[model samples]
Target: MSESKSAKSGGTAGSRAGGTEGAATSARIGVLKTYKLFVGGKFPRSESGRVYEVTDSKGNWLANPPLASRKDARDAVVAARKAVGGWSGATAYNRGQILYRIAEMLEGRREQFIGEVAAGEGLSRAKAAGRVDAAVDRWVWYAGWADKIAQVAGGANPVAGPFFNLSSPEPTGVVAVLAPRRCSFLGLVSVLAPVIVTGNTAVLVPSEERPLPALSLSEVLATSDLPGGVVNVLSGRASELGTPLAAHQDVNAIDLAGAGPELARDLEIAAADNLKRVVRPAPDREPDWRGDPGTARMLPFLETKTVWHPVGS
Candidate 1:
């Protein structure tokens, strides 16, 4: 009789444990279902109705994911152009605060992003975390510049003739940038912050091989109180969108990175049509990622506008 009671009690305990295990698994799956492309404060599928395969570092194909197309790229540009003014018009102090917010958010989510970088960049977890930390630090650095870039980069230039003249910086509206093929998110943020801090809009093309962080960044931007249209991101073949963006009459500047001579020449010609300012590539060599951010990152977004006031007697 005692053996029979013992068997019955054990079966009841096993059933309860199975029920709890099933509930925990369901919750995990629920979290995975929440991801999608971010656009205009909403999560959306690629309007092109196309999806491509995403893979993990282990070479395992992640499920169906939207392939952002040319049309989608253009759409992102439209959004960025729309947001340019208000974000740029904001007092530099407020802009700096918003940038600081992003850094805080990144730090809080460090572990999640670190793992993703490991899977996406094929970096070890420690290395990926190191890069992530650097990226977050980069944001904090730019946050300080949001209000002060003008004073640092601009000054009174003694001219052949001038009457109490001063030259100050201004934002160039609607910038298009191609991020470096390596150091994905760090490169993307480096290109972006200077432009936005100065009030220009941007459309960024992330590194082709690893794009997950760029998408994730879009999500962060969506929540960061940045106006829509200030920063647009597209992930696809850089060649496909490079010419259109660099040459587009509406865009004011093109920051080129990670391309060969053929593309470089093509963009140079396209930029000439409008006399748009083009930030040339660093000489055929690797970037010193560990170097200081000010000269390396901030200088590219600057323009030397000559204040031409006639010298009066």
Candidate 2:
């Protein structure tokens, strides 16, 4: 009887171990996602075929986003230049419609953004959600501005002695923007929307540590009828791409919001090569993107042209 009991016990133990092994084998391991750059409304891996790992705040593996190179920056500039005329020539009302469409799409995908922001920024769910909500509302705000900026900033000038004099604000062509590093979503939209709202095509380099949200946002822009090339997003180290963008003669303007003091100065000097319109950060003072970002941010990329004609008899 004792020998038979021992055999049964050993058999039961063996079955239990086998069951554990099967469970382990069946466990699901998440497939790591690869995020690519958004250029000319298309998703493409870096021309260099290189990718860098992006980790969460706690050092947890998040994704491997494409590491954009100087070549990518130049390509983005070319795309932006191609898109400039059509986008800038569109009616302001049409631009407003498209901007509003972005808001609508973002609304539909709010939860996804909230989760991304939470993970990317190391914020609580509630706080991250708040950031997403603000970002969506920012689009709505800029949508309204799209149709109103001209009225507020351009008009018939009352000249001392002129037949008919009018001042018009026009987009400054292709703009390269280095988005702020800390406030990934909000800061990005705050700078980007203004540039494009005025009808300028943009090449945006997002915050390195927090690029996932911007990459996801690019997906929204791609489907939102904003037109390809109007907004191209490159995700990688800003240091690698900034100088090339600044020095590119085809690029008409740049926003150095992401560069450190020394880098910002260097880029500003390079921008002088082509006389690029640069918006440099203040010394040791980062502009608060969350607060009301009035017309001050939008006016920099706009050029005012004055036209005068003799009064018709």
lDDT of 1 by residue, 213-233 (tens): 777787788788877767777
| lDDT of candidate 2 over 129-239, digit per residue (tens) | 788899899989999999899888999988787479988899999999999988889888998999999999999999999898899889999999998999999999988
Models 1 onward score TM values of 0.82, 0.90
Off by over 4 Å in 2: 1-31
Alpha carbon deviation, residue 286, candidate 1 (Å): 4.4
Which parts of model 1 are misplaced by more than 4 Å?
Answer: 1-42, 63-65, 159-162, 304-313
Candidates' C-alpha lDDT: 0.69, 0.85
Question: Could you tell me the lDDT of residue 293 within candidate 2?
Answer: 83
